[model samples]
Target: MPYPDEAVGFMADGPESFGTFTKRAYKLKPFEEFDIDVKVEACGICGSDVHTVSGGWGEQLFPLCCGHEIVGTAVRVGPKVTTIKEGQRVGIGAQAYSCGECKQCRNGNENYCPVNSINTYGSKWPDTGIVSQGGYGSHVRAHEHWVFPIPEALETTNVAPMLCAGLTAFSRWYATVPGRGRRLALGAETWAISRSRAKEADAKKLGADGYIATAEEGWEKPHLTSFDLIVNCANSSKGFDLPRYLSMMDVHGRWISVGLPEEEGQVIKAQNLISNGVLIGATHIGNRQEMLAMLKLAAEKGLRSYVEEIQIGEEGLKQAMQRMKKGDVRYRFILTGYDKHFARDLKI
Candidate 1:
């Protein structure tokens, strides 16, 4: 079978000016037996893309197209694949692949697989010797295992952000100690914090009895001693009084931080934990099992992602990235209007 020569979209070349992403083309890797080609219908813009392009995270490989929250139709499926047939509505999250034989993989924790764990973009594919591209382009070829079937009742745009941001929040919410009636206090910079009264909204969504927003003045004081768990999705480090916040948790409260702190060297004194019996931990992205479970929950609960739509053009992508940098999006942004040729051969 023949394949298209290239995909058209914006490509980032290290930390150059915003104009660097204009009118770029990237070569699509040769298809493999385990791959599923997707004609992208939507992709959510995420903060990680900005960090990668601006060199905020680290050195970035040039000629990269960064987007992970992808939703689309499976245009083609490899001969060896059986789970996802062509024409299936599907989505791919941040993680693209992992070595299936590793211990973490065996235990359903592919996100932490010790062997090569491929990211949706800006990461290398050890098996194919290709840099895994992303959903910013017209199409994406992902390993079948990473592709998830989008429920028939869900809209593509609404499900796009669930591929990353939604899943991140959901996974953390699910990991909290069950039956303890945990309360969540979201920090100020969380996307949820700024929109939708995050503390109360997420608390209700995650089955918490109550939540208090730390962003509002004097809101933190009344709720301090009422929570059993707190999840930090915001980027701030020093604004909150750590000792006081920790005291809010019950005797064995759990405090988990998911997003990176704005500044390095952010520290917490030992006395804070010692006096309050609070446990602090952090999480990376979800593994394959958690990813599947999250999708199931989203389907069952009618959970939807907040998203903005953008066209799949170079200028549109650049503008979307700029919006992401300024935190202008409500929760997520999904790219649409890609070429339709990739879906021509799909079979449902």
Candidate 2:
């Protein structure tokens, strides 16, 4: 097999099923003067990757390597790049471009760039005509705007998932005011009730107020129609009883779906939602400013994701993907040792 000196990644031929990862080379051409080159050190596996590779997120560009939660060391500095330098540690999230002149850009929400919002993977770069590949590769090419300098105190492995998964969860929670009124986060005990007591205790350490072990306690029967908002983060689409969840919502309550499952996974009955007069909505990845704020808060509070580290290799990546599909990872999976895996293959 030939090598892609410019960008080496474990990729798939097309969107189909999970565990189709194969190491291949992505030919890199000269990027714009504002673009910077990064040697990837670590990356987090996002649910978006699962969705895209499994044909759940609609058709995708084939031969794609999707991993946006990237942490790396900068080895090439474009002449026009003023902030990032060679040998600096940085990160890039799900976004690759947001034309700065748009209405959304003038606001602090550039991630919503209405004109041209380029994703980190599976999209063509406006500046260089390069279809943006993701971070599961030997190196990444990013524009100056989307690249972020990571904090010294944070480990690359810990901060990688914050790029997407943590960011999504954080963005929703940050804007909320749990203190303004009575509030409690509800999760069915089936999800939280780990086999061991240690798992239950770990939940308390994370500051969950209470546990609703649905199988034994039957929260729905006792607290029927008792909630205002629910942020459903479960990724599986099957067995989601939309009416059962709706029954728990008070009149005019809201349900937001952030966790994406396979296509046609969650069948929604229009009548189920009509009874409560409730609204359903969801959010995408946060903006650059939000990413910076997320890192700052993470640094200040010493917050880090509970991630299992796996050495980067074809077999290792395949196992990680499989584990994620089965819901085995505690929180996130970050792949490291990119330099060792592709030492001879990296062109620059």
Candidate 3:
């Protein structure tokens, strides 16, 4: 695959009228010694993409092409990029560029490189000022460190979501590290919590032992001080009952939030933590080491993400975005058929 002068994709012109998309071409950031050019094969549609485009996350670059869970081929590797070879399958997640000299980067925490961590899309390159676009396009340019080689066992489309959604869920810090005996013996129970029981069957089928519907009367009483850890995945804080949820935590349990809702977050007070003394924290996307480990574990376990594939086009994108906003997707959605949508002259 030859590198192209312009990357083509469906761009949203404004947040006010976001779900609508238009096909357009945007220039890639200036090539750097450590950068790698990827010819995208598939890109997962993440909830964050929706938030950013709809102005939920905040103001963003206009006419933006939004996507972060990217899986593709290494079409061009800079001279200094030794880890990946041209034509090798690779993936890029949320973070694209991090200053390698930062203490966080040196300590295997590049995801938190506060000095200069660039997102896969929206963040502008320092010197070039070219906004970093994402996998909704035909090509993506990212630093070598941010790119990961895909395992042969994982299918391109199925593994795409793991770059973001899977990784985000996998990297959360669990308050209690259960011993191997209990983990292997299957004594620990799992439960799914939602606003309604409509998805109870689906949750059970996904291996949850029980389900909790918050809409039910006294939903929190029966499960009081029961859970050892709670990983919050709420996409909004509009009506979230923070104290009620925290009451379900066992003594000294932890609540780790991984979701980023565009709306204001629920407020917490000393009173909320004083009852159970539970800890609360949040995390960003996983680091590179975690990304590789996650991919390797998925490959070894033969893990597959639940994903619906949609062809790459304006109408397809529009439909996907609309459906995603309504929570119609079972798990994740991946945009495919790139070669059909992007012009052949672009050398995808």
Candidate 4:
């Protein structure tokens, strides 16, 4: 297949407002055996994109294309790649690559690999010395290992958010399971709090037996001590009446914290875990195997993402970023309709 000469999208200079994704062109790297070139059909805008663009998560590479939750068709695949083929519907998550020889990779925990881990965009690839780019473009070149074939039943718009938001929730959910017959409670706030409910719905679709939402009024009254695991996805540092919540858990219940509060130096009381034998832990994103497992689950359960669509072009991307900053999207915003020239493909 013939590759395009250029791809365009929103480009960020530094921690600025949402008006910064200006029109620009990027050169596609020469093809490699492990690489796959995609004609982007849809790309989900995640909070991480906003954070990276605004410098909330620290320094970022300039002229960055920030979208990570990507969905599209494989237009070109490297000769060495066998898992994916040309013209296949596919998606890429936040992580782009990881050193495969590490203990984490060997154990199917590539997300926690001790060596180098490459993010989908705004990070550097140790092998090629190229600053990794993102999915907010007319086309993207990715390693075949990082890209997965999308299931036939799922729509691009609905599956885009699953690349990041759904995967994050799913990784946490899978880690929290204790045994075959165990109940779990998910505590979340802000957008993630709502995502937790969606996660539970997906879990239920996958045959999850129990999930209780703590966001509703009087939510704690009924679910306290009802769960064997409590997954914290909320950012509140005041602590959600931990003692009360822990009291409801069965003995040896586990408490996992995935949300980081805005303020630094926040501490947890030891008594909360010590008194009840509740295990407290946190996790990063999943590795390649876990990502495949997640996609398989989504395929099997017919999971869908509640995403808002934004056209992929100079003006639409700027507006989409503005709306995302204001928390206007339901779950996620996907940039779509990228033609040969990203700026010209504005129909969406």
Candidate 5:
């Protein structure tokens, strides 16, 4: 299959001008036999994108095209590819490549493949200078192992963010077995904890059983030893109170962190986890099997993510990035209008 030599995207040259995207074309990496090229449709904006582009995480590959939550149609399939075909709808998550021979990959933990794991963006191919550009482009090329076939029942825009955000949410938890039931029981009560009460209404509206505002003093008193798990999605670790947050966890409860703020992470000392025997952990994006299971579950359950859509362009991207930094977006932002921004096939 014939593929384009270059792809156009809104590129960021440095952290100083991270939000200011300029339209430019970059050369595509050398395609291999197991690669698949996707025609861009909709891409999700993630906190990680903001952190990377702004140099919060660290120094990044300059002139980077940062977006990982990608959903599109397969336009070109290499001869070695078998599962995906041209015109099939697909999605690519944060990870694009992992050494399949590693222990993690062989055991269905490809996301943890420490050897030669390449991100969908801001990661360079080994022994080559070509950096991996992401979904914020006219097209993106990825290995077949990392490309997932989207379920027909799921909507493109709704499921786009799930590729990254949803996957992270999925693989971050470890539930304990109920002492009574032979089968896992349904209905685990979920509560939303925000820094303030501003989101209480919204959280309750979204089916949260209760809401806790940290701004209110003695907030964790009523809920002492109430939670079994806490998923920390905070964007920054600045001024994070570790002991207070852990106070709500029951014995043997876990705290899993999936957010990546550029700020230095809060240091966890032995005293912090000794009282409740809390387990603190973190994870990257989910593996290929988890991605497929997540999509299937979403389709069957008719799950919809709260998303705000913005057309792809310099101004739109700039506005989105600005709002993202301020926590202005409701939940997620999906970049649309690919056909209008890039002409058919992006013949540049």
Candidate 6:
């Protein structure tokens, strides 16, 4: 299939008001080496989308398109692309390109590539200097490295958010610990995903064997069981007292921080962890192999992302972002209706 000259996408004029999202037609440049054009079937609404469009994180490039968890069929592939051919079902996530020769890339840690690491949206191509648009559009074009073949067992609608949320959670969970094909952990330690009391059911629905209600004022509740691993996914560390939480950890407990707090710097005293030998580590998105493994595990186990689907349009996309800002969605949101909304009459 030939590439469309232009693509229509929902774009916000500025960060001042993301509710002002409107459909706009933007010209598509020719596919470059290792690029694949995907006719987007579904795209997930991630918290990053809200932060980028709402100016909460920072001022972004105006008229920005911001969906990253994209699942689609490949409509076009760059001439130099060899591994992936057209018509393949695939997914694209947050990080786009990383210098292949870098040590991080060589070690299969491309997400940490120090040179030329670019995002799926709001990033520029180092060579062409063209800005990268995301999947809140008819289609998306990305380098092969950031794209992965979607497992056949997964539904596009359900698996879309896995490209981001699943990858994020799996990377933190699976990176350090290796397990069997479906079993990710093998009796290592008792791990429970903590959440605000409001999301207690969601935490359980996501397969948490244990729950911790931390939303209570001063978190007046005490943990009955101590965990060896606690992955921090909180959006805010506003009143996060490191010592109080650290007190609940057993010796050699590791708190992996993956959440990006809107407000920076909740103090952590070294003494808090000294007695227990607790460790704090941070991670971003996962490497390519990890993404495939995550998808495979998800498929084999029939693990579906908890998502609410909304039509792909100005109102639907805009409200999804706004709802994410207010923590309205259960777990994730998927944008549907791109095929019908961007009909053949409209540029795609």
lDDT of the candidates, in the order given: 0.71, 0.75, 0.86, 0.70, 0.85, 0.77
Cα RMSD of all models vs. native, in order, equals: 4.8, 4.2, 2.7, 5.0, 2.6, 3.1
Better candidate number, 3 or 6, judged by TM-score: 3
Candidate 6 ranges beyond 4 A from true positions:
1-3, 177-196, 216-225, 345-348
Cα lDDT tens digits for candidate 4, 1-348: 223644555677787554666666665555788888877888998877877776766777787887888998898889999989899999988887777788878877777766978788877777566677788876777778789888887888888888877777667445445561143323321111232375676545445555656566665666555556556765444545666666656567666666554445345687776765766666675556667777787778676776777777777778887887676766678887775454344333
Between 5 and 6, whose lDDT is larger?
A: 5
Question: TM-score of every model?
Answer: 0.84, 0.84, 0.93, 0.81, 0.94, 0.90
Error of 1 at 95 (Å): 1.0
lDDT of 1 by residue, 66-129 (tens): 8898998898899999889999999998888788898888976777777988888877777556
Q: Please give the distance, in angstroms, between residue 94's alpha carbon in candidate 1 and its true position after superposition.
A: 0.5
What's the true lDDT of residue 63 in model 6? 77
lDDT of 6 by residue, 116-178 (tens): 888888887776676777888887888898899998999999999888777887784555553
lDDT of 3 by residue, 66-113 (tens): 899999999889999989999999999998999999899998888899
Better of 4 and 5 by TM-score: 5
Candidate 2 local distance difference test against the native: 0.75
The Cα error of candidate 1 at residue 309, in Å, is: 1.5
- Model 3's TM-score against the true structure: 0.93
Ranking by lDDT: 3, 5, 6, 2, 1, 4
The residue-level lDDT of candidate 5 at 303 comes to 77
- What's the residue-level lDDT of 77 in candidate 2? 76
What TM-score does structure 4 among the candidates reach? 0.81
Residue 314's lDDT in candidate 5:
88
Kindly report which residue stretches of model 4 are placed more than 4 angstroms away from their true locations once superposed. Answer: 1-6, 28-30, 172-181, 184-219, 235-249, 258-262, 340-348
Error of 3 at 70 (Å): 0.7
Model 4 steric clash pairs:
225-248, 225-249
Per-residue lDDT over 15-110 for candidate 5, one digit per residue giving the tens place of the 0 to 100 score: 998799877888778888999999889999999999988888889988998899999999999999998999999999898899999899998888
Give the alpha carbon lDDT tens digit for every residue of 45-160 in model 2.
89888878877778888788889999998878788999788899999888877888988899767877889888888887665666778888877887778899999989999999
**Model 3 local distance difference test score:** 0.86
The better candidate by lDDT, 1 or 6, is 6
The candidate scoring highest on TM-score is 5
